[model samples]
Target: MRIINPNLENKLKKFGSDTAHICFNCGTCAAICPLFETSFPRKFMRYIQIGAEDKIMDEKLELFKCLHCGLCTSSCPKGADPGEVMLGLKRFVLDKLRRNQDV
Candidate 1:
């Protein structure tokens, strides 16, 4: 069961990509992603926008599939910078994992 945390966007900003909440789910990022047939950055972006923190953690491995070629960032009409968001998510997930290990 995924619990939604309304502050997820704010939490994500610390990792980087302060524009994480700017995405409007246009799917342009997914359309241009060369690494996966399924939606890549858009999926992550939506999770962030909706404050789906649990969902993000659950699907964290999918974040690594990003090639970070800048195509998604360049194609985003909203200037959401999906590539930057993905990088931020990687850092966020890593931090969460580290904190969990230390607990």
Candidate 2:
């Protein structure tokens, strides 16, 4: 799922390639989100798209807190899905981390 959507970039141009500034931080996502009040999709989305690799790495625990429930997707007017993307990063990083730990 590392495949970046080609049109999605332009589609989300103002939004950014990954995070998309399109995130209004309206809290609709956070409000409807079911993450036990531990989720912050708006900020998370910004960090992901900006290639904030260091920040994302540091915030790994917060990212993993995401349940990827897709409620955010349902309400997102921009169609920007922060939940699944966060999950993807979690999966990718965990897989790599686990592989290294195995050695």
Candidate 3:
């Protein structure tokens, strides 16, 4: 896969998880998402799974739109925890952005 930035891969790897492997991309995150009544995490998960790194970066503003309310995490049958994924991905992306800015 084309990784727009490999740093995120390394950061994500640090979590050392197969936690997301079981996601199956079901829409439970969407259905239960307090934000999904307007915002969406389901589509974001798909982007991450496919290594759609540019799209992820391009859509950065949308990620922060999450209210961090935890409904999506609690309701996921696959334990996909979209809320955690959102937080993790934000850290992964913005950490790099901050590093880049300092350089």
Candidate 4:
């Protein structure tokens, strides 16, 4: 069963993902990303767009793979700045992890 977090998109946006909503899954970001082997920017954006919080959380490693190189951002046709989105996701995940840390 696939779990969905409808608030995920709003959470991401509030976390500073300004261009998260602009992504249309064109795959341009993934194609231009050097870390495509690790699956990022595109995958993360898709998860955010669709509000798949569980999926996004499951792929925490993939989120960290982003180098913030800006290649994906520069090549994005929609000017979504996927690199920045990745950073935002990273921040969100980190905050979640911190809050859930075993004390």
Candidate 5:
């Protein structure tokens, strides 16, 4: 089952540079990331743009691997600010966790 949250892209836009939609999947962000082993920014950006909320939630650990080094943002050809997108993913995960917690 491919669960999709159509609102995810819009929600992410509110949190980050709002340029994620500009990403053409060029792989430049992933290529320049120090943590390329996990394909940080590009993979995560794809998840966001496609509204793959389940995949985004599944890769929470990968999301946290971001060092916020800004290299991804600097290397992005579309000014997508992928570093900020990673931070937004972190925030999204945290919020999801909090919402699922029982008080």
Candidate 6:
């Protein structure tokens, strides 16, 4: 039961995730990742494309797990730059947490 907010992609642009929507979920990023055995980068990319903000927040810790090895970025045929998007997500999550605490 996930609710999609079409504006999430636009909102993420401020945090440096401008190309998330360009990804077509081809799983190349995940295949190239040397870290987690799971979907890793691809899963996060998909979440952003579909505006699954709640899911992204729930798995926010996973963002920190990215190694920024460049493999995922280079392997992506769409030039989506999943590594950069992951970094953006880290910034976005931290900002949200800070804002929540300020309230």
Best by lDDT: 6
- lDDT: worst 10-residue window of model 5: 12-21
lDDT of 4 at 95: 88
Listed in order, each prediction's TM-score against the native is 0.92, 0.63, 0.77, 0.89, 0.89, 0.91
lDDT accuracy of residue 58 in candidate 1 = 80
- lDDT (10s digit) by residue, model 2, range 1-103: 2333334324333322354555655667777777747447666666554546556556777777777688887888776666665566676557656877732
lDDT, model 3, position 64? 85
- Candidate 2 residue-wise lDDT at 72: 85
What's model 5's overall lDDT? 0.81
Q: Write the per-residue lDDT of candidate 1 for residues 1-103, one digit (tens) a residue.
A: 6688999888887899678778888899888899756877788888888889888878878887888799988888989899999999989998999989732
lDDT score for residue 96 of model 2: 55
Give the deviation of candidate 2 from the true structure as CA RMSD.
7.4
lDDT (0 to 1) per candidate: 0.85, 0.61, 0.71, 0.81, 0.81, 0.88
- Regions of candidate 5 where Cα sits further than 4 Å from its true position: none
- Please estimate how well model 1 matches the true structure, expressed as its whole-model Cα lDDT: 0.85
After superposition on all CA atoms, what RMSD does each candidate show versus the true structure? 1.8, 7.4, 3.5, 1.9, 2.1, 1.9
Residue-pair clashes per prediction, in order, are: 0, 3, 0, 0, 0, 0
Candidate 4 backbone collisions, by pair: none
> In terms of TM-score, how similar is model 5 to the real structure?
0.89
The CA-based lDDT of model 6 is what?
Answer: 0.88
Superior candidate under lDDT, 4 versus 6: 6
* Residue lDDT tens for model 3, 40-74: 88877777666677787778888888888888888
Q: Ten consecutive residues with minimal summed lDDT in candidate 3?
A: 13-22
